[model samples]
Target: MVRLDRITTRGGDAGETSLGEGSRVRKDTARIEAIGAVDEANAALGLLRAQIAAAGADAEADAMLARIQNDLFDLGADLCVPGAEATDARTGRTRLRVSDAQSARLEAEIAAMNAALPPLASFVLPGGSLAAAQAHVARAVVRRAERRAVRLAAEETVNPAVIRYLNRLSDHLFVLARRLNRNGAGEALWVPGGARQG
Candidate 1:
């Protein structure tokens, strides 16, 4: 149980923030950037959830987004500490790290959702019902988070599962967006040169 009794700690007044293992790094470091991207994705998911609730779109999607929101926090925690095998010195317990099971769960969900959606004849244009559009936004943000994590991986020992989770999450969001769009009924598919004047 993590406690945050003080929200306005002057710890980062020097432009350096503490890592999970008590090491301090600049606020703009790759690790922090990756973590910040994940946080942004989580916020996008929150907005998607609100759209879902307001539109009364799909209860199942709301539930799924809720779970994914929690997972993003786990991802942020994993990135906050350096190294895959990092463990807490005081607790002698492994730090919170993403697992293959998490990505696999996302794969399963994506498969289940895609199974019901009609085959796409054209590329999606990222617009549909409000909830679906919000899902698209969340998907784009998750992709950005994945790119940031990949950048961090190039420089540090990032967990492989972190990348996998983000990758699968974007796909999961894409499929879920379709599901939210009435199983592709409300989806806006792109038409090649449809707007061109002949």
Candidate 2:
């Protein structure tokens, strides 16, 4: 467990922040950007969770979002530190890195959720119940986060599993949105070039 004794240490006032293991880097680094993107996705999940509780439905989806939020935090922890290995001679603490099993679990859940839903004949338009709307927002944010992580990987070594997790996570959110959309009955479908008078 990590404890915060002070919230404002005036540490980043100079536009520099410390990463894991006390390594300082500028706030605008690719790793920091990736972390921020994950944080944004997590915040979107929070909105989805609130909508879930308010509706008093989909308890299972709520639980899943809670777990994914925790996993994103772990991903942030993983990104903060540069080394792939959790423990090294330089930093002798056990760091939390995302596991392949976690990503696989998301894939399994996506498959299960999608099995009962009707096949999509058109693109989804991101509207349904409140919870479903929030899920769509989260899915877009997670996609952005995945792209940021991939960009970071190009410049530096990143855990391959984390990228996989983010990719699968976006899919999970997409299916979850559909599941919350009256079991895919209420999805807003987009018509290709159906608009404007021909």
Question: lDDT scores for all predictions?
Answer: 0.93, 0.92
TM-score of each candidate structure, all chains considered together: 0.95, 0.96
lDDT of 1 by residue, 77-140 (tens): 9999898875766779978999999999999999999999999999999988888898899999
| Model 2 quality (TM-score) | 0.96
Q: What is the lDDT of residue 40 in candidate 2?
A: 100
Off-target runs (Cα >4 Å) in candidate 2 are none
What clash pairs does model 2 have? Answer: none
Residue 110, model 2: lDDT of: 92
The candidate maximizing lDDT is 1
Clashes of each: 0, 0
